[model samples]
Target chain A: MMDFGSFLAMGGYAAYVWPAYGAALVILLAIWIDGSRRRRAVDQALHRLEQQRNSER
Target chain B: MHRFANPGRFLRLANRIQPWLKALTVLGFIIGLYLALWGSPPDYQQGETVRIMYVHVPAAWMALFAYLLVGLASASSLIWRHPLADVAAEAMSPVGAAFTLIALITGSLWGKPMWGTYWVWDARLTSFLLLFFLYLGHMALLGAFDDRARGQRSAAVLAIVGLVNLPVIKFSVDWWNTLHQPASIVRMGGISIDSSMQWPLFAMAITFHLFMLAAVIERMRTLLLEARLRNQRLAAFERVGTQARASE
Candidate 1:
């Protein structure tokens, strides 16, 4: 098994390395989550509109 | 391109491709991160810090690539008036900005260890910052007008004009004496980096590209749906208004 301690250490550059990866992960996650939420909201609105139209018919 | 110009057709195609793209992105990230973190040997000179290049370089590349797509889409929208091109360009702006932001942040993180400073007024770095602003400018211009067409047109113009910054960013290291290193992978002669490092970098770059594609397509679908919803509501309101008038 790889030594978890040294991996975290990243040969003494952990402070720089970990934060770089972390920031990227967080930003990507935010974008993905925001997009998915927006899509769901729009989809729901469309479905409601379709249902209303059907009922009116 | 013409066939896909229809938003419905485009959305259908996008939906089909999205799941595959998502899978590829996930697989690439897994392999790339594994290789970058442990599989590859540390650089002889920079040691493990060299690993930062995998993330930093790919983000930088995607930033430029996304802007290029925006500029090209803008060109098509302006010239041919392709129906989907404007939406494509608008959808790409925030994604491009996010990549640019990532690039700048990661570049700073890398710089702190290698260059002894988080930032310097280097040409490459400065031009990249300008590219980020250009993206924001494009996005803001899009919302500036009451008329959506006018907003899109103005943003398209900005995107085309911003093309000048791409070459400037690419050539800045060569043109000026700067802390940022000159091109290594892409150059006149050949790639300078070792193969051990190259594989992980390529994997991460591909992953970022796939991720960007999936994100843009998702955003476009949402935007198209929102536009449709707006139109539906307007039509419903108009119908109700006409009925009330007839009843009166």
Candidate 2:
């Protein structure tokens, strides 16, 4: 098993390393969330249009 | 390829692949993160700081790869007037820009420890900065015009012209003496990096590529739907106008 303390410490470069990884994770998550929200909005709009067409018919 | 140019067909294909892509992306990230953090051994020189390469290298590669895609798509849009090409190019900009931003930030983070400074105006770094600017410029030009087609055409031209920078960025370290190291993994000989480090890097690269594809497809779908909604609203307004005229 790896020592958790040394792993976290990252050989004294933890301050530099973790934040780089953290920033990447944050950006990736943000992109995913934003894309999902946009997709949902588009789906709702399309559904409303379909309902309107059905009512007209 | 041509048949898929139809938006309906394209959306159908995008929808089909998107779920699979998402699953693969999530799986890749899980495996990649585990390997990157623990499976790989530390570098003799950089020590634990070598872990940053797992993220930085992949982001840098994607930053260039995405620009290449955008440039090719823009060329198709301008030359053949491919229906979805402009949209593809436009959707790629922000994602590519984000990758560039990540690469730059992470590079700076790595640099501070290794080089004793956050940044330097070296050949490789400066060319990469220009790439980030190109993405922003493409996006800004797209929104600058009132007419959508005109805006797309203008941006497509900009993207194509910016293609010159791609090769420059790739070769900058080789062509000029700079703080940035020259190509290691992609040179004439075999990869200088060890097998243990290589696996995690490959995994991360795959993850980032899949994530980019998913994001682009999702954004394209949204844009297509918005276009359809605009047409529907316009049609409804026309119907109302006709009815009002008839009643009068």
Candidate 3:
């Protein structure tokens, strides 16, 4: 099992390096979630409108 | 591609594809992080600080790729007037900017330790900072106008014109003496990277691409819906006007 020190040693600047990598993942994931949610909301609204159009027809 | 040119068809495709994209993104990240953080060996010189490559390289790559996508879509919009192409191009800005921001922020985070400074005025670093501003300029130019069409047209022009910066970013290391290291991993020459670390870096890069695509598709769906809703309102207004005239 790898110890915490080795983990921290990602090459030596663990404090600066880990967070840089970590934050990239966090930001991209957040953007992904936000985008997916926006898409879902749009799709639902579009479906309702499509239904309205069909009813009118 | 034409099958997806229609907004209705596009919406259907997006709805189906989005979930799978999300799942893949999650899986990619999990696998990539493990390989990068645990599986990869430490560099003799940089030691643990080399771990920053797992994030920095991918973000930087995506930032450039996103702009290229924008330029390509802008060409499509201008040449063919493809129905929703402009919307797709416009929606890319925010996602691209977010990616660029991630790249810049993480670069800054990584630089502090490696370069011993958060930022430098070197050519490569300056050009990258310029590229980020170009993205912000595109975002602002697209929204500043009252007419949406005008805004989109202007933004597309700007994006196409801004393609010059991509080459500048690519060549900066060679052209100038910069603090930023030359492209060792992705050089046109054979991969200079060792076998141990190369796989995780490439995997994370792929993950970044898929993640970017998922975001773009989602934003495209929202733009299409917004456009459709506006059309619906206009159609409703016309119907009401005719009915009033008939009654009079």
Colliding pairs, model 2: none
Worst 10 residues of 1 chain B by lDDT: B184-193
Best by the DockQ measure: 1
lDDT of 3 by residue, B43-128 (tens): 87777767778788888888898899888888889889988778788777777877787888878877887788999898888888
| Candidate 1 lDDT tens digits, B1-248 | 57888999998998899899999889989998988888888899888889888999999999999999999999999999998898899889999999999999999999999999999988999999999999999999999999999999999999999999999999899899999998888677888788999999999998999999999999999999989999999999998999999999
**In angstroms, how far off is B151's CA in candidate 1?**
1.3
Which CAPRI level is candidate 1? Answer: high
Over 4 Å off in model 2, which ranges?
none
Q: Tell me candidate 2's TM-score on chain B.
A: 0.98
In order, candidate lDDTs are 0.92, 0.92, 0.83
Residue A49 local lDDT, model 1 = 98
Model 2 CAPRI rating:
high
* Candidate DockQ scores, in order: 0.86, 0.81, 0.65
What's the chain B TM-score of candidate 3? 0.94
Native contacts recovered, in order, as a fraction for each?
0.77, 0.75, 0.84
Encode model 1's per-residue lDDT on A1-57: one tens digit a residue: 669999999999999999999999898888888888999999999999999989988
